[model samples]
Target: MRRIKTRVFVIWSLIVVAAFSLVGCGSEKQTPPAAQQAQQVELNISAAVSLKDALAEIQKNYQAKNPNVKILYNLGASGALQQQIEQGAPADIFISAAPKQMNELEAKNLINKATRKNLVENKLVIVVPQDTKLNITKYEDLSQDAVQKIALGETATVPAGQYAQQVLQKLGLWDKLKERVVFAKDVRTVLAYTETGNVEAGIVYKTDAISSNKVKVAAVAPEGSHQPIVYPVAITSGTKQQKAAEAFTEYLFSAESKAIFEKYGFTMGK
Candidate 1:
């Protein structure tokens, strides 16, 4: 009888141990795998204000595809954004309306050189209020006596202004138009001035003119009047989100991004 009891006890102990082992295996299976749980990341994109609409669409598309990544935009004048980055403001990527701001950052070693690339091309144009009797049909017309005030981006900081200056100088109208020019804080402000009829005319990008029905394109800057209007994008040297920033910048040059930009009147740069 005692031998039978010992056998039964041993059998019960083995079953208990087996049950615990099964539970351990089941618990291990229930745990989520590290690979399945992606780490969430945030990327800050400092882009030109002119890119606002296109980028808004692009961001929605990208975020839909990449649910784990969050994108926040810092849209403003390229020069102002460059200054902010230079002064240690937080930014992961920088997209300038022209190469001048990017060149300045590159010279200062503030940008990731390997990630730099020209993103898009734009045309500078003169614009006026949609319903105007100014008879402003060309760049030459901007110098006429009827044109009391003209709005331009501040040449010291705005690339559009710099381009306008170049075009004016090329056309030999810089000296004559200098006194009539009203310096705006940014290209969009120049557009605003024209839209509000605060200025008789404004020099801005063709893309900007397409954004508003309140303004009409007077004339496009003649080819070779200024440097090629190419926007350049790069990662900031001090960015903490290196890989994520690179991924977003790569997306900016992707076919989908190109389509969005084209829809907004921008031509992709080679």
Candidate 2:
């Protein structure tokens, strides 16, 4: 009986010794994460403010797939963002809400033209407060005396405002309604004015109106009234992280990103 017990103890000791040897071998063979990972790249993406929610979601999904890459966003009015890039802001990529900014950058050779592609499209819209009793439901309705205050983006620095201006001009409402218009710094601000009932009506992108519950879309600008609202994206010519910037720019056209954009009320650009 003692001999049997001694034999069992000896077998367990051998098993334990073998397990330790295997662990030691694995420790020597397994490479540290630092040794296996490529150099980390940080990409600064300057994009339109209307893209905030969609891009945030895309960023989360992309970083999960690319552990070696980090993303930072500089979001604001497209025209303002373009001016910053022109002034040598540290942006690796630029996504403009309208082609005007991207076109200007390409003319100045400030962007990698070859990498420029239309990313998504938006609709210009008119919105009013949800609880308002006003009968306003169209762009022309703003000309009514009851619509005393109107919100519009500043055309010089805001693409939505530029489009809104074009639509009003084409509809011949610009001259009559210009006086009542209160131009905001950005499209989101226009939405804010409408939400608070500070303005009887506001002009903004469909995406901006969708982001809020305090206001409801009153009208969609006639299709041919303005230039097509398309967002274009490209890597900046001065980007030091070209490899990473290109990777992300390419990812923007992927199916995963298309779903995210559509979910945010933006149609993918052809």
Candidate topping lDDT: 1
lDDT of 2 at 231: 97
Worst 10 residues of 1 by lDDT: 32-41
- Could you estimate the TM-score for every candidate? 0.87, 0.86
Provide the clash count, candidate 1: 0
Q: Candidate 1, clashing residue pairs?
A: none
Per-residue lDDT of 78-174 in model 2, one digit per residue for the tens?
Answer: 8899999999999999999999999999999999999999999999999999998988767888898899988998999999999999999999999
Question: Residues 6-99, candidate 1, lDDT per residue (tens digit)?
Answer: 9999999999999999999999899977875656888888898888889999999999999988999999888999999989988999999999
**TM-score of candidate 1 to 2 decimals:** 0.87
Model 2 lDDT vs. the true structure?
A: 0.92
